[model samples]
Target: MDTPGPRRLAGRVWIVPGDPDPENIRGSVAVVADDSGSVVVDAGQSPAHAREIQSAIRAAGLPPARWLVYTHHHWDHVWGACAWPDVEIVGHVSGQEILRREAARPWSHRYLRDEVRANPRLGPSFRARALAMQGWDDFTILPPGRTFTDELTLPTGVRLRHVGGAHAPDSTVALVPDSKVALLGDCFYPPPAHLRAPDDGPDLAMVRDLLSDDYEWYVDSHGEPTTLEQARRLVST
Candidate 1:
């Protein structure tokens, strides 16, 4: 609800921040535009979120993104790809496998049932909303037609790199050469211990390797966007 857009990154680049409390919404979506067209890094969690992103896109005076780069295979970032069905999707091979197995599945309803079975206090509203947001009838999971092991030159004027981090398996980091902004999906920091133990699951060494002084800013799905200098310090800590 924090005025979704016109949040400039550098020049024609901007960020459409996700719902900070995206228990039911989507993740932060990054956008970069040029003469060729615009590109988005990660969609949100539901069709409603996607529609919001679309509004932001139009308000930005930008065309629909030519491509969608999933930061990882998590539902929060990739589920909303349905909103931009024409955009060419990009992600990792392992993540493709996940899409094949789980995308469009009744995974949301299944999870909800599990929760309600354990705790009746959850009530029906939560279940109803979850199902609706899951985009049941037209729900989909689009595997990146273009797969990469390490790096690739994306059509969207981004140097895409497969940055394996403490997050999910198919993490990608996009660096806008002209703007000097790095759009890194949720590949930093660990989830709270209450949600999941601090696995420190990402490859910090890989992260440090990816973190160079060239980028001016690093964008993630949540939290304050960090600068290259600041992110290096945070990584060390």
Candidate 2:
């Protein structure tokens, strides 16, 4: 399938939809434009993908992305940080530890393949998907430069709250209060079976708590944008 461009969501917000292809799982990237500039959520899976998002953001006539925020430290959600050296990166404090650890690991194809072979249960799917993408020569992982604890409100009024769950202990939710849009990342999904993750699924209670807010739309990293009613139904199930 041809890669799609960023689609507008609410006032000053747009999403570069994710590709669910088994071999190349690209997570969605959200952009919130404010007077200062664009606040992007998730740098994407690769530098190439991040470049596409940057191009799309420019094409949409939104300001250049001044801030790149990570919902978690997962590779699919942040490996593209290398592409935005000029943008300030933001993430949960806990995610910094994970990214630091990831930075130490050798990301070469052979090393990754060997690691996957030796510890096949951990993240074979992630390895397979990453390997399928083009150019691993410059595939560098970077930790966030600026970290936050419970919550942070950007200068633009985009609020970020740490709402960790089963998917990731450092998972966060980005809320554009004025726009009534929330970017939920992959926090609502259960861990992949291959990882043998101990937790059953995301904290639905915390997720449900979000429904009490005034968000009109909820977007998961790999799914279509959903209305409040649709989001409620999803959380219930």
Candidate 3:
């Protein structure tokens, strides 16, 4: 619930959190800001949260969002994307398909029912959050304007390399090469394991190897910024 501190790296990249809670919402939205423009990595829980992200971008003297990159098709990650009107949205080709499927399914409703069944203690909070998320109809089916399997570069000189997936079927970790900072979505999070482990799509070993090669600082979608060494240690354990 606390606001995450903003961080800046070498390539004029900034990491801002859209949501910090891990129990209900498993991911934190991030913004990759540079001189040319800003690209929102993932939309947070609601339109208001997405608006807060937009406000943060404006406060930092950046232009309107030029692009949106969905790490995967998870509801929490893509729901608020409608807040950005007409911006080019980008993601993996598989992610595009997942988004279409999610649009047809009662994802939020199912999540609410599952939350109550799994943890009765937090059922009230879960219902409240789920209802808040459902009220946002902006999650229209918007396919990625640009899709890639391996990697893609934005006009602002940010390179989004799809190292491997960890959190979801179409999940990808975005790397800003120049900054040596990687936006490893829900692939990595702080310890004590609050959420269920994602099905093993991209082997953790592959992710570890990818991180070791070029990344120095890693900005996770859930927790605080971590170093490659720290990530390796976490994965090893």
**Candidate with maximal TM-score:** 2
Q: What would the TM-score be for candidate 3 when compared with the true structure?
A: 0.77
CA lDDT scores, all candidates in order: 0.73, 0.83, 0.67
The order of the candidates by lDDT, greatest first, is 2, 1, 3
lDDT tens per residue, model 2, 141-220: 89989999999999989999998877788899999988999899987677665654565766678768877558899988
Model 1, 58-166: lDDT tens digits are: 8878877788888788767777787785778888877898887866466567666787688665535345347547346777777778788988887666888876655
The regions of model 2 sitting more than 4 angstroms off are: 122-124, 197-199
Clashing pairs in 1: 18-28, 165-202, 166-202
TM-score winner between candidates 2 and 3: 2
Report model 2's TM-score to 2 decimal places: 0.92
All candidates' TM-scores?
0.83, 0.92, 0.77
Tens-digit lDDT string for candidate 3 (18-134)? 454444664566677765567778876566567777777777776667889887666667777777775788888888877777667554667668867987765655664575464
| Model with the higher lDDT, candidate 2 or 3 | 2
Q: After superposition, how far is residue 98 of candidate 2 from its true place, in Å?
A: 1.0
